[model samples]
Target: MKKRYLASALVLFSIGSLFVGVSAISPLEVFDLTEDQLHILTASRFPRLISILLAGASISVCGLIMQQLTRNKFVSPTTAGTMDSARLGVLVSLMIFTSASPLQKMSIAFIFALLGTFVFMKILDRIKFKDVIFVPLVGLMFGNIISSITTFFAYKNDLIQNMSAWMQGDFSLIVSGRYELMYISIPVMILAYIFANKFTIAGMGEDFSTSLGLNYRTVVNLGLIIVAFVASSVLLTVGMIPFLGLIIPNIVSIYQGDHLKKNLPHTALLGALFVLVCDIIGRVVIYPYELPISLTVGVIGSGIFAYLLIRRKAYEV
Candidate 1:
């Protein structure tokens, strides 16, 4: 949880991620590398590693923002219909824009993801019951409905195969030219850090923010826009990596406390470290073969989610 320890872990795993693939590259080979090895390092390894780090850090920070705005630790893109709606937007893009560019596709996805998240927030406003756990359950149901609609349309239009590719998160296909879209997350993350204090104030509740002369609605909307963009960008680039956002922030808050500004750095570092470690395990568990990141993260994240739920329940009792 300390900055020094987290930084050390991030550096170690990032370096390890660079060398764990099918390519036979080593740290010592850095000084003298053949053309083939250099190509492998630059074309595949480096890009994949960069995507993993950005996707992990960006999504986890987005999760922290959502939790702050919603005042619930469990809310994230995964549970809040953001990712599902982004996938739906992707399907719509494939159907309408046969030759859509990456940026165009991401734009559409961002719009839909934002809309879905906004609708969920509206529902939250209307509900009188503010159960800690039930709000996200409703969000889950909403996302499932959107996913079902996307699947139905995908089947009718025969785009199910293409849609399936974006259903799971995998970095195996990442190459230098293919993964540049993920860079969009870098600026979004910076903006998140910049607005950290406002988000902290916003999370204290709208009435509290109003008392402090903050424009609560504007801050909340800005936070959602950030979440939507990051969710859309990652979905467009790497597909859905469930619970990376949800669990990482919660874990960070456990050690770092609930202040968004204080917790941001740890959340980002831990998220990247978690993904890098999972990706390495996926690469080696069946040598020369690979497991998709979604599966690996899903298995581990779901276990952590269950534990968190149990802990929350125990506290209630």
Candidate 2:
């Protein structure tokens, strides 16, 4: 019943998104759209909606996978250096392949993201006792080191201005051709769904999964690949949407429970709904001008993160 509400709300917001921009179009006028209005709907609004749904769903699922595998509620791409590494990869592309297409940039970013995440997992392996807060804090420190390197290179090569485009997530610029790369995450997410049970067992820790006849290392590597791939696609397409993968899964786990397969659909829907709400808020906040989706989501996600931190013990994550 609650799931129905979530799905209905998502549908409603999706329709509402089509009419929220500077160009005036109404639900009532849909059948009578002027050529300009039709173009706006087809070109900008629809693309933005699809990007939002894809990004929100994919990133949120990535966070869920991270938390499960690490056995830490706070772990996510935002904290774990994945986004920072991708940004660095993008900077490298701009410096070397000045005429690089979006696909080239995404491919490079995926490789760097995968490597960075692998390094973090190795760091996780070194920690004898993984304090819940301590683990992600280490990741944050690692990400900051990566960010510092990215900034240094950007300044050295005079590419800081180019790098700024990826500093925040925005949907206003999305149009047909540019956003198709985000579709890559769709098939990747289906792969995640296929491996959900293995992921669930892998989350039970190395000894437990091994005793249960699961190849723990293989599952963990597969999980990291999914996370890195999804993070790269989203960063390439939407820029950085912080705390998205972190908060959405925790929220769903509260209501839907921790089974990855059971929670996947709920997490995806709620994530899309949350991002759509934030995007709508960003659009309407100043009437003609708009806030960045990063700003709006950051403000809200941080508040919720604070609440979750306060109640972390109750959640036992």
Candidate 3:
């Protein structure tokens, strides 16, 4: 959990990711690279690495912010309908704006994701029953409903193949020309860092934040917008990587404590490290073939999630 250790691991994994694919770009040959090697390095491997780091860091930070604002360790974009709604928005873009560019599709996805997150918050406010676990379950069910609607329309329009492309997280498709939109997350992450202290205040509850001269509602909304945009952009670019956000932040908080400002950097580093490791495993587990990121993360992340739930319950008892 030490920053240096996490940074060290991140650097090692990043360098490893650069050399892992079936392209035969060995570190040993880098000093005497061929023309095709250089092109592959510049075009494919580096872009995939960058997209992986950005998606991992931004999504984890997004989850950390949401957990703080909502006071639920379990809440994240995956559970909150944000990703599903964004996928629906993608379908809408393809259906209505057939000639829409990727950026335009992302714009539509961002709007729907924001609206979906807003609706989740509204429902959160009205719920008379509030169990830490149950709240996110509600969110998961809501997300499923949106996913079902997306699926229904996808089947009707014969766009299931298109829509399914974004359902699973895969890095195989990312290359230099295709992944620039994920860069949007860099500035959004900066905004999160700037507002970190206010987010901490907002997490302390509305009355407490108001007493301290903060506009609690504004800060919460700002956090949601950050989550929505990051989630949408990542989905637009790399597809849905479930539980990266939820698990990474919780792991950071356990070791680093709950102060949003203090833990942001650690969360970012650990998130990137986790994704890099998972991605490398995905690449090598089958040797020359790969697993989709969604599968690897879902398989591993769900186990960690289950353990966390049991641990939390034990401590509460």
- Name the regions of candidate 2 deviating beyond 4 angstroms: 313-317
Q: TM-score of each candidate? A: 0.98, 0.98, 0.99
Error of 3 at 59 (Å): 0.5
Prediction-by-prediction clash tally: 0, 0, 0
lDDT of each: 0.94, 0.93, 0.94
Write one digit per residue (lDDT tens) for candidate 1, span 231-314: 999998899999998999999998788999999989999998899998999999998999999999999999999999999899
Write model 2 residue lDDT over 1-317, tens digit each, in one string.
Answer: 28899999999999999899888788999989899998998889999999999999999999999999999989999899989998999998999999999999999999999999999999999999999899999999999999999999999999898788898899989998989999999999999999999999999999999999999999999999999999999998989998999999999988778899988888889999999999999999997889889999999999999998988867675
- In angstroms, the error of model 1 at 296 is 0.5
Scanning candidate 2 in windows of ten residues, the lowest lDDT window is 308-317
Error at 291, model 1, angstroms = 0.5
**lDDT score, candidate 2:** 0.93
Candidate 1 at residue 197, lDDT?
A: 98
**Pairs that collide, model 2:** none
Single out the weakest 10-residue window by summed lDDT for candidate 1: 15-24
